[model samples]
Target: MLTRTEGIVLRTQKYGEADLIVTYLTSDRGIIKAFAKSPRKTKSRFGSSMEPLTHSKISLWGKEQASLPKITQSDIINSFHQVRDDFHDFISVSKLVEMLMALSPENIPNKRLFTFFLNILHTVKASEQGSKDVLHLITQIRLLATIGYAPRLKGCGRCGGKGLNFYPASGTILCSKCAGTPVGEGKSFVRIHDNTVRFYTHSIEWPIHISNRLKPQQVILSELSTLLDKHLTYLLSKKLQSSEFLAGVRG
Candidate 1:
């Protein structure tokens, strides 16, 4: 069957000598792995559309029960090349792509998530005066929310109260009164400022467009990042490799 969809290129790998195995987050389809024949040679048709972070309109040949579809055509909708050129931009984009690739399951249609990803690529390119770190954190928090793992920020997870403390290991945001309650495998906790709590609450309530410019202080950003890092690690049962890459890129 011939399938047409527009998707963001999550990553690509060389398949044999001249082809690529491309992973994409599509508008209609959740995730797809397509094989592009001979995209590496001189004057090959795929060009740079297969590069990571490129959003492309793609055509694929789907086979019944196949591991990956064959790519018949690809057109660059927005290469998003600028996002990769700046170190700051690249770090943020890499984190978004890698997290999405890791947690998003295959072939499950999620239009909201797909549109959010596209908007972010555009936002990162258009941003002039903003905290890329804050933007990156917002993106991560939003994805976690969409996937039903968002931290409970408004009230305690164990009890209903407005005063909350962050517990990373059990993935709960507990009220001050309930915060000391022991959780299994008690993991470390990060000190979250009032601003960080507000940031976390706002992210859960607002859309990305509204939350894009919320430049929290560097201290708050660091605290929230540490909190979410622990939360995500606990949920995924592993550290994110893209985070390591992001640290290296930022430094």
Candidate 2:
């Protein structure tokens, strides 16, 4: 069967000599892998629609049981040329796509994740003052929320106290009193600064439209990155290679 959907190209790789294997995050089908014939050739039908970070409308045909679907037609909806023009923005967006491809499950319908990815791309492309660190932090927080690993930022997860601190290992907030206590076997709480706590609390409550209003301090960004790293390691059992690469690039 042939089907049409809106999608963002996540990544592409050469297949054989001239063909391409493209992975995309689609509106209806989550993550889909499709074969694009002769995408590298000058006269190829797929054109730039197969390029990473390209948003497009795609038509694919394949058997229901086929692992790799074949793209029959594609039209570029947005090329995000401005982002591509800058090396920093280009790498940041590429890392975002790599993270999504690694973390998101195959063939699962997650509209929130899809929207988050689209919004971040748009932000990166449209921003006059670009900060890749800010974009990376936003993506981390939203990815956690989308995948059901979002940390609690309200009352304490243990004692129900209003004053909260994040425990990254467990993805919960603990009160000052509760922070001293051991959460589980061999697990201890990390002290969260007031600003860091406030940052997480505000981020969780604010709508995506107003998220830009919350400017996280550098200390808060570092803490959040540490928190995400610990939690992701525990959950995914693997370190994000792109994060290391991004850090090196920024340095």
Candidate 3:
């Protein structure tokens, strides 16, 4: 059987010598891995369509329950090379990709998530260099919220009381009373600034296109970024490789 779908290349891993294992977030299928034959050769039909973050219309040949379908054809809708080419933007966006891959399950149909990710790619490509930092940070916050992984900052997750310390293990702010409770006892927390909470709230509440208008101070960006890293680290059980690279670059 043959299947047709629109997909954005999330990542590609080399298989054998010339073949490749391409993982994509698709319009019809949430996240799928397709095997491509010899796309690495000098004169392959795929061209650059298999590159990471490329949006392509793809044809897969396989059975209904095939674990790994074979990709027979792929035509590029957008290469997104501009985002891939820039070192800073690419690394930042890579963190989002890593998060998506980690948090989202495979072979589930999620059209809304697919559209959200595609819009993110376009937003990153068109955004000005000066605003990319805030844009990327906003994107991260939005992505987490969309997928229900966003950390709670506005109030305590359990009691909705006021709190300044964000507990990564709980993935939310915990009030002093709540923190002293048995369930929250002994867990460490990061003290977040009020400005960071305000910026995060707006990031999720406001629309993405107008996100560039939000000019947060560098300290706010750093604070939120670190908080998110801790949240994801606890959830994923390890730190993301791209995040470490980003830290090294910024440091």
Candidate 4:
């Protein structure tokens, strides 16, 4: 059977001499892989629509349980050309796609994750200079929330106190009393600043809504990145290469 859906291109790789295997994070199907014939050759129908970060309407045909679907047609909706023109923005967008591909599973339907990715792409392409980092941070927060690993920021996850500090390993906030205890068997506690706590609170509670209005300082971005890195590693059960590169760049 043939089906049409809106999807965001997550990644692509050479499949054969002239074909490409493209992975998409679709609105209806969480993560899907489809084969595009002759995408590498000139005058191919797939064209640039198979590129990472491309948003398009796609037609696919296959059995529901098939690992790879056959792509019948694809129409580009947004290519995010501006991101391609800027090196930093391009890298940022690529990392976002890589993160999605790493975290998402095949055949499951997750509308929130789909919209989260699309919104990040749009924001990265539309923002003026110097907004890439801010946009990236916001997207990471949203992605965490979409994947059900979002941290608690309102009160301590350990003690439920109003005054809170984040423990990345647990993906939750901890109060002063809770902070004194070791979060893990061997790991020591790291003290979090009040401002850092507030920033994370906002990131979790308000997301893009509040993050868009407030510009976080470099220190805050660094701290948040560390926290997110720990959480992602815990959830994925491994470290992300793109995240490692991103951290190096930020450092």
lDDT per residue as tens, model 2, 49-120: 777788899998998647898988999888777777888888767756665776777787677777778887
Deviating ranges (above 4 Å) for candidate 3: 43-45, 183-186, 238-251
Candidate 3, residue 240: Cα displacement in angstroms equals: 11
Best candidate per TM-score, number? 3
- For all predicted structures, in order, the TM-scores are 0.85, 0.79, 0.92, 0.82
Roughly what TM-score does model 1 have, to 2 decimal places? 0.85
Question: Which digits, one per residue and each the tens of the lDDT, describe model 1 over residues 116-206?
Answer: 7888788778766556667778878877887777876666777777754677765777766676666454745665777888878787677
Off by over 4 Å in 1: 43-45, 176-184, 238-251
TM-score of 2: 0.79
Residue lDDT tens for model 3, 207-230:
898988898998999999899888
C-alpha RMSD between model 4 and the true structure: 6.3
Please state the error at residue 245 of candidate 2 in Å. 26
lDDT comparison, 1 vs 4, better candidate: 1
Candidate 3 local Cα displacement, residue 116, angstroms: 0.3
- lDDT per model, in order? 0.78, 0.74, 0.90, 0.75
lDDT of 2 at 192: 62
| Worst lDDT 10-window in candidate 2 | 183-192
Query: Which of the two candidates, 1 or 3, achieves a greater TM-score against the reference?
Result: 3
